[model samples]
Target: MKVKVLVAAIGVLAVMVLVGCGGGETSTTASTAASGSTETTAAETATSAQPTKASITVGVLVPQTGFAANYGPEAQQGIDMALAEMGVDSGVEVKIITADEDVLDASNTLERLKKMVETDGAQIVIGPVFGSSQQAVAPYLTQAKIPWFSFLGASKDLAGSGGTAFVWPGADQLTAGPLGDYAAKTLGYKKIATLAPDYAYGHDSITGATDTFTAAGGKVIQQQWVPLGTTDMLQYATKIDKNADALLMWLVPSDAASFVKEYRNLGVKIPLLMFLGIFDPTFQEVGDLLVGEIGLNEYNPNLDNARNTAFVQSYKAKYNAIPNQTTAFAYTVMENIIQGVQKSGGKTSVEDLRAAMNGMALDTVIGPATYSPDGIASSNRYIVKAAQAADKTYIWDPIETYENVGAPK
Candidate 1:
């Protein structure tokens, strides 16, 4: 997998658009301006470091327009939040140069990433969120000898390739696999109908669920694949088998919202199991209808651990919105890079950073995370429910936690 999965659209379009960190045509050079927080202390002190460099340039490849647009800004926010916590103003200056990760035409990503590495001098590059975008650009990342990290995740297909790593809770199948098991063993869902956008990520995620679902004695009576970028979900919704135990769906953001409207309009009441669908931005629009529904998530804002508490508080204070998985992962990947630099005594070479980061355990917003040599992350996953909170605000309440979750063997 190349910066393989887990974009905001990793669930819907954010799941599809996801997020990446390569450079592109329309660019913004910026940095974090927020005050210090404990996360800054955590990232810096998480590993031993010498602030050797005054500044480092990071190139971001995220789609600024089209299906994945909802994810890019938040991902940048995550990077900024992490940089601030690492003391951007007070210490190391991290420069951000953004490029559009054109999900439509991936060649654009490769061309722009070249500028990021060659012309702009991005020492550590962040994205190219979609799997196809990552695949198009992987050769250059290796050729340039730039040690890159996925703000989202790279897929399992890119595993063990040089100059890269996948953030576990990454690979789409890994993140959703437990949900398949959960649907069978915990929820006692015996038969279900599945729906997802027809794409690599969509196929991989639903497979993650159904593969385990079937193994545990569940049957998927029907499977639907909506063409990527199709917004008319009513047609797909109308075709679902109402008698199945539940409907499992993963669409891009717009498509997901459209699907919900049609699902409700049709009074399709079989219940729902979604991949990160009932969360923010999405929840902000469809929360009222999704109450009591189940979804799979890579990050939950309600986590109570010290690391997550600090991350959520600091992030909310800075951005005034609950940090979604995109933001959280962006923050975590930045920490991974910064810490690698620190561990290697400020070496920016990919060879050095990769050696430093791989297998170096650290507390992340999503809990314990460590990168394997192949660049796959071993992290955690969540089974969440959309619940109306006391404040009448909608939140993805984590009902279960699966530790050290990674790609299924």
Candidate 2:
């Protein structure tokens, strides 16, 4: 999954998250939120008021029929894990309605979301998973007064005063800016070339790095944007600045596979700085091919924390495998919704829930989660290296962790 889970000729700005499905996507509670006050006291702010509703409905959006279709089942698995954890006796009844994110068509995304809210009575929703889809459906969420908890990632700018949008794991820029810094100051790259899908999430992911990279005294000599559904990379690959120290790339699953295959065949010797998803476990070729390369990671199932420990145990017990980034993002969103409803005494009104739990600290699979007044989120970001596991499968190996990071500087 692209954390941005993005691609398409859609306009910029996209969300559960707005940016990546797997890195090309977005999320937050794996750490702190807002100005960080919620980390220690979000629980204290919960109102002890009595129940206002016996049941709450949550709408979940996933891409079921596009290039990102594989991500749907993973998200569902995460949602199920959260539901099972919430169980049947948590006082508030949780009903779930499903819809396709439809990242390809903004209009379809809006239409489906409207049905979820207007007909199925979803009070809060998770996803509109791609950045473009999130952008397409956000205004509707605001007008309907429903909280949009992005399981993917979201733009900080979209989290305006409506208090209806809760962006987790910060935005694309927040996620990638650190890599910029690392590349400049740590990796000591002097110049770099970049390639990404020509869309909202791609721009944000690249800009996040270029901003920090430029600020840290590195030059981005060439930047290439690929259109959606363009899997053939010969035209783009031939033009890469061979003189640049490295090439940074981000793309949807299929396109990423296509481009890497082309890049390898060309025998380009430039070191690579990949955005997330280049090594997604789902794509065995890219992961195995990129082994030993460095990249940004939104989630690593191996995160060491009691909450994560328990989360991994439960997920493994159920799925017999580790939850990937997309699954973790969905699980975190579901956990937030469940906790918010429980803490606010089953109050599911859009405004009531936002007021009751905005910036509330959550121990999510990602980490501790919190929100800004404008709904921007905070969490952990990781710098990881691609490595092969014992079974010959590829996995992200965390080399460094950035805790409680909010938007980029």
Candidate 3:
């Protein structure tokens, strides 16, 4: 009986061991399967967790249907050119929104800017072409944390304030310094006569010329400020008499044309130096009357650079329109922003894009371009002579190219 009981106990113990081994194997298999499942789920979640799509919405804050309507289509043409170069594909969509800022009143200007920023949700802003409009939009843009760039005559009042706005070609210095220096040093002009519209743009330009010319051992013999849109400028032309070596006229399109017409009529033989606005379509109405005028241009259509040549060809083909200097600057601005976005992996955040813009150095059709945090564009300036093209329209022939005028140190 004792032998039989011991054998039975041994058999019971063997069965128990077999059951425990089997259970252990099953548990290990289950844990391995669970771990694999967990890893697959995590990978799936990661694949689904990418950031949302980015769309580029730029606010064209120019006067499209107001006093500056002549400049409206030109501004739009610039943006269109930039968008084409940027290439809207691979999750980037460029949307341009336009606003009309009435050039007559400050309130209307501010209202239009506010609509573009708040109502339209524009991440970038282009213009409000006049000085007053730019001044009106400054505080709003600063508070809203939106970047604003303008195309107008330089205003020192707009600069040095740590504002959210930047002026291309650096308002006063870029426009006036080079022109003044060229006249003073290269052309050997001792006495310069100045005439510009009585406004911030004209005043700032005159101030820049005055300061730079004086510093470079040149004398400003006489300075005259005239009201804008003055139809009869024979009286002003009479101011450009035998005493002045050269006349630096800084009027806008209409007034400048009038002055040029009257100067020719009055037979004033002194060489005239003027700004970009002096060569607008209206001035071309005066035709060969402005054959020998020497001026500073924003960008010369006849500049024989690879970029300018391509731009002109593309512009004519794409829009069936003649390109101008303002449009060129506008194109440069948009291209600069698009490059910044592309470099940042298409980031939509303003801060990231701003950082990208600050670090960017672009090769523009106008010339080399770079911007500062203060919103100043330190691009090159062009000096050109007005010559009638074979097409019988006035075109600027680039005489000197000051490449990279405002490069940061």
Top candidate (lDDT) = 1
What C-alpha lDDT do the candidate models reach, one value each? 0.73, 0.72, 0.67
| Candidate 1, residue 330: lDDT | 82
Per-residue lDDT tens digits for candidate 3, residues 1-409, read: 9999999988887764433222232222332343244323333332344432455667776654422456766766676666555543323455566666555455666776676668767787777677766767777877887767675544544533556665676666456667787888888888888988776667777776667677789888888887643557888888765788889887766667777788888888899887665556575787588676677776776777789889999999987866887788788776766666676677745566656777367677776677666546677777777789888877767788666554233
Model 1: worst 10 consecutive residues (lDDT sum): 30-39
Name the Cα RMSD for model 1.
8.4
Residue lDDT tens for model 1, 20-51:
33332244432122112322443454233544
Q: Where is model 2 more than 4 Å wrong at Cα?
A: 1-53, 277-281
Better by TM-score, candidate 2 or 1: 1
TM-score of each: 0.84, 0.83, 0.80
Q: Which scores greater on TM-score, model 1 or model 3? A: 1
Q: Which candidate has the highest TM-score of all? A: 1
lDDT of 1 at 132: 69
